[model samples]
Target: MCYNATTSATAFTISVLCSIYLIYSGNKTHNNVDIFAGIATFMIGLMQLLEYVLWKNQDCNWINKYASMSIPVVLYLQIIVFHIANKYLYNATSPTYDNVYIIMNILFAIYVICLLVWLSDQKLCSKPSANSCRLVWAPFEKLLNYKYGSYNVGWVLLLLGFLFYIQFGIPLNGLFYLQRSFSVHKHNYPIRNIFPYITIIAALVYTIVTDGKRMSDTFGSMWCFLCVSYGIVSIMHI
Candidate 1:
């Protein structure tokens, strides 16, 4: 997802280091949440490594196809795992919240299915910047242009769906924390308590700004980088 292989590799290395730290700290403090977060971070790093391979290959070969496919699948698995860990940590047993969670997962499943279908017809091509390659489907771009006047709409919608899919858990977790905070008589808001909301807000702002200013082709790569980097940094607050 990075602009180049070096950037992707660097991100992977940083993620690995952060993952190790999180796991070690979790074990020392006996916090299973941190341990789960560490696993998620490691998965993000693995995705970055796959991205690095894609960047290096930049071809229509099986290696590029599988690497590109793995990124989304890994991301989907990581988010599901993280959601389960968070629910377990919070003991989220409310029927209403559980129903909402199920609905969100169903929507995310649909998005992933569409995304995989879209990717199946895409081919790797160099970006206008020539600094990196991206997956492009000429027919999709033409269809968007014909229907909407702008080719960016499809990418924007896809990105929005992805954002909603990954971030839906944040508010659910936040609601639980807010209720617990009110009942616990806590005077100060700890970083751990507000980190999820902060992450959601930050992600929204970053994606909006980047998409507005950059080419549509960069949206997926840039967002993947941001999410993984945020995942690494957010471990400290856990």
Candidate 2:
């Protein structure tokens, strides 16, 4: 579980750094793009790490699986946006976006490969524990064809995540301003009220919609769990 272990440790580290910056930035780095990426980077990084290592051992380390597959899409999008909009936010290179993109892309590719191996085998849920890394080539003589359908129960879940992602940051700006506000007689520091119910819903939909043996199944399901769980955990800690 090197990936899993690394991801968890990395998430904690990034979260700590972001937390410090948020708490003690003293209005200095308030508009930093790197700062904005603090939570996004940590959440995806840690989640992917878990997915890579855990999947090597178990067919489904349900939580890690979601993180590994789904969060990259966000990371990819965030990096692109932050790089383009650095000044409005901050300088371009605070959080090592280059390394994040390169490393995440590689990790994403590996996890996909692992999923391919799993899909080729029929005995997905039932198996003995040790050293079960299957080959890239299919175990069965006939190759299994995987499909991603537009119409399904899974659409409901995707919709839920879409909504949460859009709404979660409404009061987040004020969260960074909390310390200064605390000294005042009355204050309304920004706050975000969010519950990641969509993440779970998405996972269920992915499960119902996709073929269990396909790599898409592994990634799609895991993505939902990681996104929501990471958000919930981060907010609670905050």
Candidate 3:
């Protein structure tokens, strides 16, 4: 998750290779679901590539504005891909869960729209390090502190908790239920069953290990990187 042009380019390359392999294997095996997963993988790679562009052209205002705008859309598309894949792979057609997905997408849409609107007046990009032009929510920091009070640890924790729950918790919860309901042999589905927990743990580790100052500078970028990078794990399902 290092925010540098080199690392971003490398991630994009790896994701591209992995996506090609996954798609080719899916085609040969006639597994349409795998194709969807491959597409998701490619989306993740696309995001990293966008980051690379932003890193390289940090001084270009138009490039930064459009590229920054594209990031949230790409991130949201990943969730849509997951929803489609879940339906095809697990036959997850439960109306309740479908409604949950719909609501989640709506909420995510509002969140993205609000963020983009809020950052419209300010530069949506940040140069956290000499070589890094990372997307961040720095513009919101002042507003958040002003609204919630400065040095409000509780508010930060609550905000992060909600973000994580929306980004990971709900989808994983739905997946967990779907897997259990669909699997023919429950005992054999260890990896799928525990994957959500693993993801949550990894995210927690990320939050704990990232430098606080760096986290403030690149909180949005860090979370997006974590989500996209971990998306490679979809290969396991494929």
Candidate 4:
């Protein structure tokens, strides 16, 4: 008998759709973290959808238990972490270039490390329990090398994107209608012609080189989607 979890399905569908719509609209407009951040958001939603639907249909209790209980929560938390990271980069008004981004990323790394330790220490929740599904993080991180080296490099690029958006994009495009008296053309933005493009391309190329084929394929797809969408849209509006 097929499980009748329409509520879960509906929730996932709504989230994914909202994410897609936001990305599309945000891309066509200008640099919006709503679009950049939507990648992780939609991935979380997709995982949730798979947990509910795939788990039930496959008749795999373990898969359901693991995915529904642990995976979605972990994915959700990661998405939130990235969201905060992006926001921090966006609102950065500091004069020191790269310092703020480096500091922001350092804090983020510390947070993730602490979170992993706390979760694994078994004080927060029982391992493999309904709420104890965060165990996937430890081994996964090790195997995927999602820390220090490659991951650190990736964080730097993301930080660049956020800072670029805040300083250049917000001023030129006017997100919250903070219009300036000094008129400047859309294409006149400093990083518009170079930094963003180079940053994204370099990130994907590095990931492909260092992280092997799997990560290359994975983040490469995301890189292509984001960079291409932003390029096309930004160019069109220019």
lDDT of 2 by residue, 21-137 (tens): 543442464423223434443444443444444445455444434433444344334443433433234322335534654565455445445544544343333112233232121
Residue-level lDDT tens digits of model 1 in 1-238:
5656787788888877877887788779876556655666676577667767777776557676666566556666765765676656545466886687778778877876786787676663322233335533232243233325644476566556557544653332335534643344322235644554565566567657776443434544644564356555556463
Query: For residues 1-238, what per-residue lDDT tens digits would candidate 3 score against the true structure?
Result: 3467887788788777777876888778766545644665676577677777777777747777667667656666666666666566556566876786678778777776775676566555534443245545333443344344445654464375357344533343345544644463222334534554565556656667774444443444544454355445656662
Against the reference, the lDDT scores of all candidates come to 0.58, 0.37, 0.58, 0.40
Stretches of candidate 1 off by over 4 Å are 124-156, 169-211, 215-238
Candidate 1 lDDT (Cα, 0 to 1): 0.58
Q: Rank the candidates by TM-score, best first.
A: 3, 1, 4, 2
TM-score against truth, every candidate? 0.67, 0.28, 0.69, 0.33
Candidate 4 whole-model C-alpha lDDT, 0 to 1:
0.40
Model 4, span 12-124: residue lDDT tens: 66556656765687678654544543454455355345434443543434454344335324433443444343444245233453465455555545544554453343322
What does the lDDT read for residue 142 in candidate 3? 31
State candidate 2's TM-score.
0.28
Over 4 Å off, model 3: 130-174, 177-200, 209-238
